[model samples]
Target: MIDNLIQGVFNGVSTGAVLLLAALGLAIVFGLMGVINMAHGELMMFGAYTTFVVQNIFKSLGEPWSDFYIFAALIAAFIFTAAIGFLLEKGVIRFLYGRPLETLLATWGVSLIMQQFVRSVNWVILAGLLVFSILYFGGVWALQRRPNWDAIKNWAIAVLLPLTLAIAGSMGVFMAQIYKIAVTKPWFGAQNVDVTAPKWLRGGLAIGTLQFPYVRLFIIVLTIACVIGIYLFLEKSPWGLRIRAVMQNRQMSACLGIPTKTVDALTFSIGSGLAGIAGCAVSFLGSVGPNTGQNYIVDTFMVVVVGGVGKLIGSIAAALAIGTTSYLVGSGTFTNIFAGIKPLVDFFTFFATTSMAKVLLFVLIVAFLQYKPAGMFPQKGRSVEL
Candidate 1:
């Protein structure tokens, strides 16, 4: 019983890592700007689509450099989503910043269009892309069970232990409001990842009874690096200061020579990029369908609120909490009993685990809002308001 409980906790923590990936960017966006981007999930879907493209690229080339292609997918997702997010900020989000309701409706419309486009694609190609991709968790599982990386695990714990905790409550995410890029590194040296792979790249590390896969480990490392890099950008840079200034008073920042609009576009792209990466991470775990982001969109919002608005720190905490809690009671019993009653006789009333979890999550978020509208760690200022 104790062993099972311990295992459950480990699983929950792993799942929480996934949630954190999705929620961190949302927090950054909302924290810096007052925009409630309804299209956030759609942005993530774009990333998953990037992974799909990479898979297809490999297949078309006869799987030339498989594992390397996974890396290519990640890079493509960041670039692709960032471009779209920037366009969104410039094209529509710029004008709709202060209008929450209008932004929601407009983005929702965009999401529907994207969904239809995905649905229109060839299903066979889609399956092949999702099934043969290197990021797939099944491949990772095979490597983790082998004997190696246990040494690394022992060392990583000391580092990850404090690192994870520090990230949990680091709600000063408002730092993005004050940050700016000092040395914008152009993407010129990026080598296109080939479609074929090296078997060694797809393995794992063991810790006691715990078995962690290489893909997950890669995800953990990449997420940490991004988080730390962004955090430093927000806290330690002069531009970060400008970003904060603009976030607090856009008019003042502009008066002070800060290009508020540029920051807004860049920030939106950065946040959206994070979502894209998360989408790519998830593609390896299951079917990379067009609707992949749909299942997670609501839950991501719930984390954003539960953790606190504009608070990346709060967002991370909320993501972990929600992921762990939702998976705890098991997706089975929890979903069947907690699912919302659908209007159609055979609809939601019939019961479905994943759907039920979502239903329960929505209800909980509603309750959380009633109690703490500002979330767990709202910003601190007249304009820093949630």
Candidate 2:
């Protein structure tokens, strides 16, 4: 019984670590910018796909290179998803700011589009589109910022627009040919893909009677590092300070030369990047599919809300509480605890089954929210007014 209890707690912490990873980005994004990013899950999908691509690339290189692919995949996933998030903010989210309903609808549409694109479009074409978007948007942004270029802007547009398109098109064709030569068949199609764990991460570590899987341990360690990194960035770094200032008072921050717009873009990108990392971590647990992100979106939002929006410590505490409760209930730990009491045993027995655990957990969350609607740690200042 003691061993079971210890095992349950360990399993619960592992589960909580995954939840924490998935919720971290959502908490930051929603807390900082009152925008409910419906497509946040899709960004995670992108990260998983990025990992898939990296895995294939490394595999093609040789056996030795394949073992270290995860490291490269993590970095690639972050940059890839961060770029997408930045483009998303600049292209669509920027215009929908302060309008929650529209933002939600737009992001939902984007999510659907992304999923379908992955299912229908070839990887080569997706790469081309990504390249095109980056170059085109980058050039336009640069042109827009130029001083007193209005007179020549039209001519510059006429020359630069086609040039950018031509260059991007050429690159796409070049990449496609190279891809065809290197990989005879497409790496990904409509079906899901699996990311195999490295040899080092396989199996479990034994501590007395309890066993801990390396993958779960890695996730826990990674989550701790991310939390610490974010804490340091927000507390000790200038950009993080700017982010907090903007979060506290956007208009005032802008007035004080804080560049609120840049802060928004940066914050969103970081959040998206974190989501990507979450996806990479998730890939180790199961197959990577287009719909993978959807699985965690609801739970992630719950974590953020229960923890109190914008409160990091609150998020951590909430994740652990929710995760542990769910695991304990599902594992019948609660039912066992009530075994000696007839009435309590019957009550827990009914609710402690795997299928019913989620229902019970949800009910508990609802009850908790009824008592503390602002969450365990509500934010003060202009955030409340907004």
Candidate 3:
């Protein structure tokens, strides 16, 4: 019984780690920007797909390279999703700020488009587009410091136009050849793929009578690192201070010569990158699919809401509480405990199943919100207005 309880707690912590990873990015974006980015999950799917791509690339290299693919995949996932997030904010989200309903609807539409894009677009074309986009954006950024818009435009046309055409032509020819060779290949089809764990992570660690899987341990450690990194970045870094200031009072921050727009773009990018990392972590647990982001979106939002918007500590505490409780209740731990008591046993039995456990958990969260609508850690002082 004691061992079971210990194992349950461990499982709960592992679950919490996964939730925290997924929610961390949402918490940052939602809390700071007050934008309900419905497309956040799709960004996660992008990360998962990025990992899949990296894995395939490594597999083509050789056996030894495959073992190191996960590390490269993590980096690739973050950068790829971060770029997507940056574009998302600059293009769609930037125009719809301060209007929650419209922003939500717009992002929902974006999510649908992203989903369909993955399903319909060929893999090679998608990869070529990603590469082209990165180069195009990088060039634009390099030329952004020009003294005038005209100068920037001239440089872009003279330098970037030819580069774009060359890339497009090459990709077009390469894709045509590949298509001709393997017109019936499933790689060209939109389907789910698996990310196999490295040999080093396949085993479990034993502590006394309890056994812990390395994947779970890795996730927990990764979560801790991410939380710490974010904390340091937000609290100690100059850019983080700017973000906080803007979040607290956007008007005042702009008045102080801080570039609020830049802050928003960077913050949103970081948050989206974190979501990508979450996707990479999740891929270790299951198959990667175009719709993978849909699985964690609701639960992640719940964590952010329950924890308190823009409150890191609150998110951590909420994730742990929700994760542990959900696991315990769903696994019949409480039912087993109350087995000797007739009334309590009846109540526990009804709520012990996985689906019912979620229902009970939702009710509890709703009840908690009624008592504290601002969540576990409400913003204080000037941020209250925001």
Candidate 4:
């Protein structure tokens, strides 16, 4: 009985760790920018796929290099997703600032587009080229709009820039396709790839009668490291200071000459990059798939909401609570507690036969919100104002 209880707790903690990892990104992005990005899940998917790509690259080199691929992939996922996130913010999200409904719809569309692009290797290359083209054209337009450029120079810039962009974009796509045909086809064989845990992550650590999986332990450690890193970045770094300043008062921050738009773009990229890291972590536990990230998106939103938007401590506490509750309830430990009351036991047993645990969890969350609508740690600032 004690072992079961201990195991349950371990399971809950592991679940909470993942939730914290996934939710932290949303907390930062939504907390600072007030933009509910429905596409955050897709960014995570990109990270998982990035891991697969890196692993395959290393595999092609030789088995000797495979072990270290995950480390390289983690960095790759962050930078790749961050770059894409930066472009996403610059292209689409910037225009929808302060408009919640439009932002929601637009990001949802972006999510769909990203998912489709990730559905196949061919699509991924094509999407990259498309994005490159868009950014290229957008830059030209911005340069054209600049007041410094005279008419002839502007015309020359416009003509030369588009031609250069077209050639560059076409060359990039052609090279990507060639690599995909020559390398990826023989190596990966398919878009759906399996990412196995390293040998070191297998097996378990035994403490008396209870054993914990190393993969879960790695996840817990990674989450703690991320939490500490984010805390320091937010509290000690200059970028963090700007984010906080903007979060406190966007208008006031802008009045003081802080570039709010640039801040927004950076913040979004950081948040998206964090999600990418989480996705890379997830690949250690399971297969990377097109919809890999969608599985956790709802629970992530719940953690952010129940914890209170933008509150790091609140997110941590809420994730633990929810993760533990879900695990215990799913494990049927609560059945013993309800055994003393026959009617309640019977009722719960009836519901427990299916997904009643999740239903009960939702009811509790709804009740929690009813009592404290602002969440466990509500932000007090004009930035959160809609």
lDDT of each: 0.68, 0.85, 0.86, 0.82
Error of 3 at 214 (Å): 0.8
- Rank order by TM-score, top first? 2, 3, 4, 1
Candidate rank order under lDDT? 3, 2, 4, 1
Alpha carbon lDDT at 10, candidate 2: 81
| CA deviation > 4 Å runs, candidate 1 | 59-64, 121-204, 331-352, 384-386
- Candidate 3 per-residue lDDT over residues 242-330, each given as its tens digit: 98898888888999999989999999999999989989888888998878998778878889999999999999999888888889888
Per-residue lDDT over 55-112 for candidate 1, one digit per residue giving the tens place of the 0 to 100 score = 7776567545654677788889989999888878876888988788888898888887
Q: For candidate 1, report its TM-score.
A: 0.70
TM-score of each: 0.70, 0.86, 0.85, 0.84
**Predicted structure with the largest lDDT when compared to the true one:** 3
Task: Report the poorest 10 consecutive residues by lDDT, candidate 4.
Answer: 182-191
Q: Which stretches of candidate 2 lie over 4 Å from their true place?
A: 127-187, 336-349, 352-355, 382-386
Question: Stretches of candidate 4 above 4 Å error?
Answer: 61-64, 123-135, 138-192, 336-355, 381-386
Candidates 1 and 2, the one with greater lDDT: 2
Better of 1 and 4 by TM-score: 4
